[model samples]
Target: MAELVLDPESHFPEELGIYFWLYPYWDQVSVRGCGYMVRWGTPPLVISILKFTPLAFMVTWNAHPGFTIPHTNLCDFIVGNGAAPVDLPLGFSNIPPQRYPEAPGDEGIVLHTPLAYIAERSK
Candidate 1:
């Protein structure tokens, strides 16, 4: 099992908009991926993983009706309340990055994870 945490300062959003946070776990023993979803409305903003990697993964946004934003991971541009800490299942794939390709979707502006989680998991 691996423990994951979200950095409040790095992951929190300063303004309101579609936001996403990704947790990528990769190691010789296993690779686990997990995170949360937030939106302005019911069901909140839903985010799904289209591709996974040791270093990073690609996520897609599923906005509710009236939400016209394209699917994209906006982890870089927008700031948010940061990612809430969560626990994820453990397992890994032998697949390589080239085997998985990024699809067209909304741009992810805010991407971050907790430094503690990474450190603990790496150990």
Candidate 2:
């Protein structure tokens, strides 16, 4: 489990985005899926419940897929007190990532598009 605590005073007043890449070893099923949750000033939000096929992981690490923080119900989340801890907890599951939240099956080999957010926010 990796937790990222964003300092509001230093990070706020502007929108922020997160991105990552997964490169599981080809030997076996490196991971069942990856879970991401955000705890801002308000109630916690589940950002992503993602998985990959074995074929996806078997490729060269450099060829692994890139993932961006999708736009979920986060627009309202941006409007916050900027005092409470803004926590981002990311994890991988060999079993289920969490029980209360059930993950979906077979998200396919590539999770997200290769496009990035430019200054104009164009794809």
Candidate 3:
């Protein structure tokens, strides 16, 4: 029998990862035949049965021909290894970077540079 190898480009995941902002709206996550925009938030997890997944979805959806994240796109995929769970502190959406310490109760700090942005940038 001939062996078949699935390259990264052709691999399709059984489930998809979800962004944290969509956590509350997990019910809204669906597999549309078209495609979906995915951006990393915290870590990979399965919320209920949603898979709360991220990487898999991106690869699968993007595998389709002519897939693209537009120049005018409002979002970009925040990539992560999805290796483990993320434990964010209260009101802190992302893990604080070494250069920038967590500023609790400091709205000004976030106004210009949000922790989420910092985390995304760190990635």
By lDDT, who's the top model here?
1
lDDT for each residue of candidate 1 in 1-123, tens digit (9 for 90 to 100): 011134445442323233222325342111122233333233433333333234344343444555443323354443354354444433344433331222222322222233212223344
Cα lDDT of all candidates, in order? 0.33, 0.28, 0.24
Q: Residue 52, candidate 1: how far off, in angstroms?
A: 9.9
Error of 3 at 22 (Å): 4.4
Q: List, residue by residue over 81-105, the lDDT tens digit for candidate 3.
A: 3233554322224422222112224
Clashing pairs in 2: none
Rank the candidate models, highest TM-score first: 1, 2, 3
| lDDT assessment of candidate 2 | 0.28
Which tens-of-lDDT digit does each residue in 34-120 have in candidate 2?
332232232222232222322121111111123333322222334454355554333344333221122233432223223311122
Per-residue lDDT of 63 in model 1: 43
Residue 35 CA displacement from its true place in model 1, Å: 23
Ranking by lDDT: 1, 2, 3
Q: How many clashes does each candidate structure show, in the order listed?
A: 27, 0, 6
Better of 1 and 2 by TM-score: 1
